[model samples]
Target: MQTRNGDLSQQNGAESNSSSNHWQSQIAAVTRKLGSLPVQELKLRLPDWRNSLSTSENRLCDLLLAIQCSNSAADIHPKLTQARQEYEKFKFLCQTAQRVLTQNLTHYDLVSIAKISTTVSQPNTHDSAAGRSPALPVALRDRGSFDHFMQMWCIMTKHNVENMPKMGYKLLDLFQLYIQVEELGGLEKVDTEGLWHLVASKMGHVPNSQDATPISHIVKILSGAFVSVLAPFEEFYKERMRRTAAHWNICGPNVTPGTGIVPTEVHCNIANFGVVFGEVNIGLNDWMPEWSPYAKILRLTGMDLDQMQQQGWTDDLIRLITKFKPTIDAWREVLIKFLLEIWQHSQSMTGQHSLQHPCRPTIQFPTSQVPCEVASTIKGAFSIDEMQRAKLVVERLTQDILQTRQYQTCEVPEVQRLQMNYAVVDAHSLAIQFERIASLDYIVFDDQERTKTHLDQIALLKEQHQILQSGQQYYIMSLEEVVTAQQNFRTALGGIKNACVQKVKERQQQVTINFPQPDEFLIRSLLIKKS
Candidate 1:
């Protein structure tokens, strides 16, 4: 009896398998027959065959679902492709019908078209959550929003709305998702093409030509805008990364063994030039640990990573991120330690390290204008009239040399050798740095207002520097003239002294000639007196 029961089970299993095969074969035959129909014939005769085609489509969807439920969708991709082609053919027919009616269609006629458009655009369950519109249904919303946000920046009236094109509802959702991600500071992390692929897959949007849907085209358009902001921010982020690596390379374990103390210049460089990255505002004050800028950036990046993982990131991406953990950890640890050391050193030297007056590093100008401008400003501030007068004196002396022709062969050195008593040139260089530091020092990590103010101050400084640099050329030229005049004067004085000495010698020779008989006269007078 047990053997007979086993035999009956085997027989039933074989019959079930045979039935599935027959069903699959029949589905294949229908797909082949549908494929052979000419596009024109289908267009002209679709209405006659619409009911039969609908019936066949319903059967095919049912079978596909069954295959998915049984975990066998992977075994028959060819049949699925044929089924998809037939579905697209139907979509084409609908599109053709819409074109025919569009010119004559009334507002009432548009209602069904709108409904059909909305139905087609609705996202599947897989790509629904992030993209689902909060205000309007997918069918009711303006499709223009997917292409350009500015077009729908305000309340979009019907007049401004474009005619609905063939696009997936999921595609709209993807754009919405892009907007959300941008708002949330995920623009830097967005992989536009990968994101499209992921979202399309989730939304059950298969790319096909016959459907006439510009889903890919829309995504490409959306992606261009999406990545526009990203490129600049990424450049800045990579610049930060490069700086971080450079700092680590310079001051890390490779530092010569005896240099226990980190250099002040190193501390200043990191403090002044290092930028804050991964900045996010969670809208909660005092929620962070000690309010370090680096800490905030680190937290933001970590949170972004968490979001990526939560959004069904692939294993390869996960692995790539995991590989970076050691570097990230090392950087974090090294930075914390270095900043701590700087703080301690400051405290030891100043009795208290004031966060209110944080180390403001020197702000360098893009041009060599800073030093030149500062110098010129210093010169002007100290004694503008005196410098101009001194310049006039040099110019007059230069005119004398040119008019006299004696010093014509002489050339002034590139740099003037004049000894200036005015202390502003030295003070100007220090003052520029001092003022920048003062502005930056007042900017606390949490004060956005102060940070903006600091940036404005830097801009002002740059402007002043440029103005000073322009003024410096005149001052420098004047200085060179003064030095040259002084040199020429010394040369003229030496020449005059030599001429006087020569004249004196000639007078001595004349005196010697006149006094040649003086000794004989003295002898004659002495002899007469003795007689």
Candidate 2:
């Protein structure tokens, strides 16, 4: 019984050794197969076989090298083919990690490496050997231990991709990579042509090529893989852009160019927005009426006066007279008629004949001397107070008449006849002067006070005449002296009339009359007082 028990123990020990030998033979065969592939072929196939039993072409290559340099499989504890494959996969991951570090890397590249490493390192039931230990050779096992080191390498190389030139790589290469990854059922699926079209659209390039298979075709083929490879980089760039945009306070909804149409997202935050400015109307046919006789007269007079003044008439007084000649002529006729009518009325009040004794003879006294007793008795028939009152009435009446003529009605034939008969051909000659005065809103009245004082002096002379006549002192003055004084008075009156007309013309020339004002009444009052 003791002999049989020993035999059984020996038989079991032989079986255990045979099982280990079988594993050793399998491991040796795989190591030989791995070693047979050239380094160039390994490098070329690394990316393709990354998820295979070899982990990647680089890991397989590294494993083959490691196995070739190590002691024989029989001397060391041998592992199963499955164990060898896992070992190869682990070694491939290590080599891939090293390669990844050697090249320029990015955060996305590191992430991919991490994922691939995790997948390779995870143990599977399919990887268990039937007769041998599941653990690999010590040299091969060292590859798995290098995982932490690979991760650190990835971290160190993460910033390298940033150093790449923007246009160094062809845009089409990225497109093809994207398509391949999509076909492999990677993270994302993208339509290659559609993506190209989208990019082309953004760039405003029309996809109207004549070639059946253009460069755009290759771009389409690679689009999916391109997107996959670039997605992380794109995300990284997008994150950077987002941060930059935030820094610039540029967070806002998309807006259409040229239309000023705000998106709903931004519209809600707008407090007050408006576009009140507009182009001014500059259309044809905005000119003043063509048939306006007053406008025509104003144009003619203005042109003529400007021409006259341009002919070296620098004296303000002369320029003033020339500028207002037409208006002064009109006012002179009106004043003469008005004064004649007043004298006729006064003569009738005194029971005197205007044709025989004529009211003109009453005012024919020297401006500087007293009137004789005969003319004084004639003036006494109307008291000095009554004469002054008459003059005031004449002034007010003339003002009303001038204003009524100017604003109440358009130029009719009868009105023109009345104006022409009064000796003025045009009323608009005064428009320029009146316009200049009115524009000031009377603010510059002080500048014109000297002219007003001159007018007051004329008024005082007329008053003195009436006072002398009422005191019966007109006989002391000779007929020749009286005629001379009367002529001087008429010339002074013409000057005053010319001055007023020139002022009106100047005002009209400088300002544009769009609306009426109280100055119109003042102008008419002055006209009436002159008359």
TM-scores of the models, in the given order? Answer: 0.18, 0.14
User: Which candidate number would show the highest lDDT if scored against the true structure?
Assistant: 1
- lDDT of each residue in 1-531, candidate 1, tens digit only: 999999999999999999999977975675555546554554556565566468658867976886878766676667767777777666645434422222122222223322322232222222233543322323223446333322221112111123222243422344454444433334333453255544444444546667655677755644564454323333333333334334334333322222222343333122211111111211212345344333333443454566656747566655554544444444444445444443343222211122111112111232223233223222322234644554454345434444653212233243431222111232233233433322222221234343333333333333333323332211222334333433332333234334333433555544322211333332332233211
Which sections of candidate 2 miss by over 4 Å? 1-221, 248-531
Residue 214 of model 1 has an lDDT of 68
Summarize candidate 2's per-residue lDDT along 31-101 as a digit string, tens digits.
55544555556455655555554444445455556577777655333333445667666665444432332
Model 2, global lDDT: 0.35
Backbone clash tally (model 2): 39
How high is the CA lDDT of each candidate model? 0.38, 0.35
Instruction: Give the Å shift of residue 269 in candidate 2.
Output: 7.3
Report residue 348 deviation for candidate 1 (angstroms).
14
